[model samples]
Target: MQPNEIAEVLNRPLSQELLARDLTRLAYVATDGTPRTVPIAFVWNGTEIVMCTTTNAPKLPALRHNPAVALTIDTEVHPPKILLIRGRAELDLVQGIPDEYLQMNGSYEMTPEQRVVWEAEVRSLYDSMVRIVVTPTWAKLIDFETTLPSAVEELVKQRAERQGA
Candidate 1:
């Protein structure tokens, strides 16, 4: 997809909901040449998707070796809102806690006292974290209303041709 097309899909209201969502399934190739998909927390900053992980995360090595990745963000409803993305992972190791991490988890409900405790624990446990940043090269949004899957579109085309013939 062209950059403008990707941006248009991502800027749609339904896509915005997916971007606001807390989790996305991150898909990448592992070191053993196997595909791995894991549910991970993410924060989309309009231009990029940022996911924080431990400095020594297993995915880090795989991402470093092969930067290509895909992500799926969707809903569990009947007419699910789906967002598919393809991008390259750029790992940035930041000292101390990443603010994006905190902001991404901020939506979860917690008592003020619990929040403080959680922050302390997170701060004490990790000295640094790896931010996996993905700048989308391609994207598609399927809300099943304004848009349909490519396969569905093709099926519709065949049906119309047969009727006309």
Candidate 2:
């Protein structure tokens, strides 16, 4: 997909809301050639989705082997709004905690007192971090109210034909 196409889907109001969401399910090919999906916190910086993880994380090896990835950000309402993104992962190893790490984790709810403890724990745990940067190559927004997945759209047509047959 062209850059304009990616922007067109993600720039919509519903897509923007989903992009602001705290958790996105990331799917990628594992090092063992298996598919893996995990819920992770991410921050959208207008153009890219940034996530942080430990330098020695198991997922890092898989990501290094296969950069292609998919992300799903959605709401849990009756008629959910979903934003689907396909991208390539760019790994950056940083000496100190990256800003994206803090930003992505900011959505976790915590009392002021608890937050202080949490921050302290985070500070003590890891001396280095890795930033996973994803630049969307393709995108789809499905509101159910307004749109549907491309494959589903095709499936609906097929069903109609079968019914007529």
Candidate 3:
């Protein structure tokens, strides 16, 4: 999709709500050829979704093998609002701790003292970190009340035609 078209979808109210969500499920193909999805902390940087992981993370190998990925951010309530995105991963490896990682984890329930301890422990444990960057190529917002997946929209149209016939 063109960038502006994607921007339109991302600008929608439902999409805005999903983007505000703290956790997103990242789906990618594993090296072993299996599909894997993991819940990850993410920050939407207007034009891209940025995520961070340990340098030696197991998923790193898989991501290296295949950069294509999908992400889903949604809520648990009824008439859920979902934002689905497709993108290619761009990895940036960095030494020492990263500010983005700390920012991503900040939304979780943690006291100021706990957060201080957590940051210190993370810095001591990881020699380096990897930032996974993805510039969304496609975006869809599915709100049962306001929108549906494109495929579902087509199916609904087809069913309506059959009924009319």
Candidate 4:
């Protein structure tokens, strides 16, 4: 999709709401030529989707080999609202904790004391991290209201034709 078209899809109010969600299913091609999808915490920074991982993460090698990836963020309710994004992952190694990591995981329900301890544990566990940044090249939002899966949309059109016949 064109950059402006992707931006237009992502700029919708429903898309913005989906972007605020904390977890996204990241899909990528593993080194073994198989597909892999994992649920990971992420933060959407208006223009990009940022996910942090350990320096020695297993997915790192696969991503290094093939940066192309897809992400899905959606609601769990019936007639789910979904935001789909495709992009190339750019890995940036950073020293110390990244603020984005903290912000991404902050949505979890936690007491102040729990939060402090969690931060301490995280700080002790990792000296550095890799930030996987993806600036979307394509995007789609499916609310089942204003938009829908392509197959479903086709089915709706076929039904309309049949009814009109």
What is candidate 3's lDDT per residue for 13-108, written digit by digit as tens?
A: 778778877999999999989999999998887888999998888889999899999999988988777889999999999898667787888888
lDDT of each candidate versus the true structure: 0.94, 0.91, 0.89, 0.96
Best-first order by TM-score = 4, 1, 3, 2
Give candidate 1 misplaced runs (Cα > 4 Å).
Answer: none
TM-score of 3: 0.93
* C-alpha lDDT of candidate 3 relative to the true structure: 0.89
Candidate 2, residue 119: the lDDT equals: 75
Clash pairs, candidate 4, are: none
* Tens-digit per-residue lDDT, 1-165, candidate 2: 999989999999888989888999999999889999999999999999999999998999999989999999988887888899999999999887788887777788888888789878888897989989999999999987678878888998899999995
Winning candidate number (lDDT): 4
> Tens-digit lDDT track for model 1 on 1-165?
899999999999889989999999999999999999999999999899999999988999999999999999999998988999999999999999999999888778899898899999999999999999999999999988878899998898899999995
Total clashes for model 2: 0
Rank candidates by lDDT, best first. Answer: 4, 1, 2, 3
Give the clashing pairs for model 1. Answer: none
Which candidate number has the best TM-score?
Answer: 4
Off by over 4 Å in 3: none
- How does model 2 fare in lDDT? 0.91
For model 2, the run of ten residues with the poorest summed lDDT: 96-105
Segments of candidate 2 deviating more than 4 angstroms:
155-165
Q: What's the TM-score of each model vs. the native? A: 0.96, 0.92, 0.93, 0.97
